[model samples]
Target: MPETLPAPCAPEDARRVACIGAGVIGGGWAAHFLARGYDVTAWDPAPDAEEKLRRLVAAAWPALEQIGLAEGAAPNRLTVAGTLAEAVADADFVQESAPEKLELKRSLLAELTAATRPGVVIASSTSGYPMTDMQTAAGDAARLVVGHPFNPPYLIPLVEVVGGERTDRAAVTWASRFYEVAGKSVLTMDRELPGFIANRLQEALWREALHMVANGEASVADIDASITEGPGLRWAFMGPCLTFALAGGEGGMAHMLDHFGPSLKSPWTRLEAPELDRALRDAMVEGCAEAAGDRSYADLVAARDQGVIDVLRATGRLGGTTR
Candidate 1:
């Protein structure tokens, strides 16, 4: 048997969490941990990272307040560590949101593994790479798992949790429970799947969008509308499966699948991805800019945050959230 390190405290019982990397995702995670009333220690190598991270948490605080902050939640609880070792030395749970580079992740996790006390659960905010590939370099791979979150993770409820081949089932369970206690909706996966569940579906949708834009088959505005004005509304309360299940009227998924399964042979969707050549990339960027119109990026972010909060309230997921 591989040597097991001493186990850390249960996630629900954890008081301090470590966030490795302080870019958008990492900073969002820091905001989340702070909102959940945990003392968060964050480490980042970039210049001005401490300043940037604090600003991010500050920006996210209003939205978090709307979502209802935990009793003791406060931004003053965050600490920026000068070194990776210093950040995670006493963390009960460690969340790594480092850059997606394979080698960086490999070395970072290994470093974290060495520095963190035994039994502490470590999770990566990796969007796609399977944990198996990333765990080889870790000193204790059994305690590492992926805890993928969507953009603007401070308010987004979905968190996909999965373990690598070498990861202990207990760790996976621990991370899932931890995310739940932290007010996230957890999708605990059974096995490793590329992009996991949500991203795989999202990537497929995105690929088709790129194909359309590249071929002049659709404008960015058209594509955005096709979802926002159409399926996106239903998607707030129900997924594509459940939404389509209603398409069969009195029939359920079985009937709906039987009715539309034949359409699977249609060439409507371009499965092959469009290359991100300069021209295509420019077109995508310009199209988005046009779609943004008068709204700046900050304006868009605030609008989106409020929109999500409204959606959560409407869906009864916010537990009586008012505005």
Candidate 2:
């Protein structure tokens, strides 16, 4: 174990951040921190990781700037570190985006715990692992928590904040406030759970999607289009619960539940999720290709970002509050 360093200054007064992995998610984390005016130092063992990190920042900055998320954001606030310790040294906040393997995360968190100040909160970007599992390897586990972000995090601003059994409530609250101030939707979980909220919800939809394609009910493109053209539009503003509430007229959730409750026990629905077999995977690839037509993944992602920006602006809900 390493000696404990001094406490970090207040968040507003802190200028430095450390990102432990420079992969896709780590790069996004670095971009968000740098865009918010914090100098970032990141580390990854992969060859050319530094260059990749720089490119990710370059690519994400323009989209963020277009939406005023990067207004007054300064350059030269990002750096790549040669080692894990080098990354977290003197950092105010450490954001880890390493691989999902438990042993790998344990080793990394141990190193990070040794390297950073005790007062510096170490936030993991792990989407599936429970916070308790991630913090177990840390010497000071209380400072570790889940700060999972959605992909293309610089543009889509939903972060699920989860605390381990030993995690400090103050840490969770401060983490929520920190992300909110940086223009993010922070959903704090009441308890630690695998996949958190968004990923679980996403997995549920994905399971059904896979089932539909596997059973020849729909093509991958058809499934995506079904949501993109239908529920996706409604979900852009309010979630499924709220949307159904409105669907129930003045009776709200009670009326909706009464009308749809019977479906809960229905055997017609494909309640059991299908496995992602090779055939389904190939079909999905082909379906996506068909959906793409001439548009590249880059083009599709940009379009989605623009649509989200438009919806947020139209609803007067962009960057206001996280409540």
Candidate 3:
């Protein structure tokens, strides 16, 4: 491994950012950096990657504009690089959003680390792969970290950042600070957690929902409504743990847990995932199509972006505050 490297610049002072692998997540990251007034260079191997990336950025620019752009933000600031090396040659930070295959990730990170400046931080957008596993192939694992972002990275504020065993503590701290400097809400994790925090919680609920569907208990639409009409409202602002604490009616989390702890043993949730057989697969697809009604994919995306923007504003997050 190369000698431990220092960051080229403070996160706030970073100027050029590289987005490797120009798919949805990669494109979203590019849109985000561009909206924040950073010089963005992106690369992908797909024949039409540049066209698709530009379209995705163009489509997302409106939502970003609604949220408010940095002083010099503009779509014209983006550059599509022809190769991986060219993309990160001068980047102060590199964000890799390649496909989720393990071997592919390992090789890509290794190549990315080799091509990028030794001190530049390289973050993977893998949803669940631990940084420890992904950093194995990197020449300088000290600078590698996992920077998991939600879909439409331009609008979503929460980014989960963590480092592997070989990752430097300073790298983790730098990545977290950089994400904040770029206008993101950061969750700096001490240890690697498979699926990270949010995804693990979501998977649990997702498993139970699938189980209910498999058992003929609840329709997919019902499951969606159960969230949208119920706990989802509270979750938009208050997280589950604190929201449940409110259930104690003044006694708070301690009393609430004491009273409901016994029910934990009840067979209410099926943590194990149900088999995704042909029938279940078809059902899920059909259910979503039905729920989507006549809305096109673009229409749905627009609605989701606007909805998130409204939520952020209502919560006062757009102004970097809360009511």
The model with the greater lDDT, 2 or 3, is 3
Which tens-of-lDDT digit does each residue in 1-323 have in candidate 3?
56466898888899999999989999999999999999999999999999999999999999999999999999999999989999999999999999999999999999989898879999999999999999887778999999999998999999999999999989999999999999999999999999999999998899889989999999999999898767786678656654565565445455565576566666777553455455754554455555546766555556555765777677676797757
Expressed as tens digits, the lDDT of each residue in 193-221 for candidate 2 is 77899899998789888888999999999
> Residue 269 error for model 2, in Å?
3.7
- Give candidate 1's whole-model lDDT: 0.85
What lDDT tens digits, residue by residue, belong to model 1 across residues 1-323? 25354466776798999999999999999999999999999999999999999999999999999989999999999999999999998899999999999998988888888888877889999999999999999878999999999988898899999999989899999999999999999999999999999999999999989989999999999999898766786677556654454455444445555566566566779764454455754554455545556766566556555765777567566798554
Error of 3 at 156 (Å): 0.9
Worst 10 residues of 2 by lDDT: 1-10
Query: Could you tell me the lDDT of residue 67 within candidate 1?
Result: 83
Superposition error at 73 for model 3 (Å): 0.6
Give the winner by lDDT: 1 or 2: 1
Sort all candidates by TM-score, best to worst. 3, 1, 2
- By TM-score, the better pick of 2 and 3 is 3
In model 3, the runs with Cα more than 4 Å from the true position are: 272-323
Once all C-alphas are superposed, what RMSD does model 2 give against the true structure? 11.9
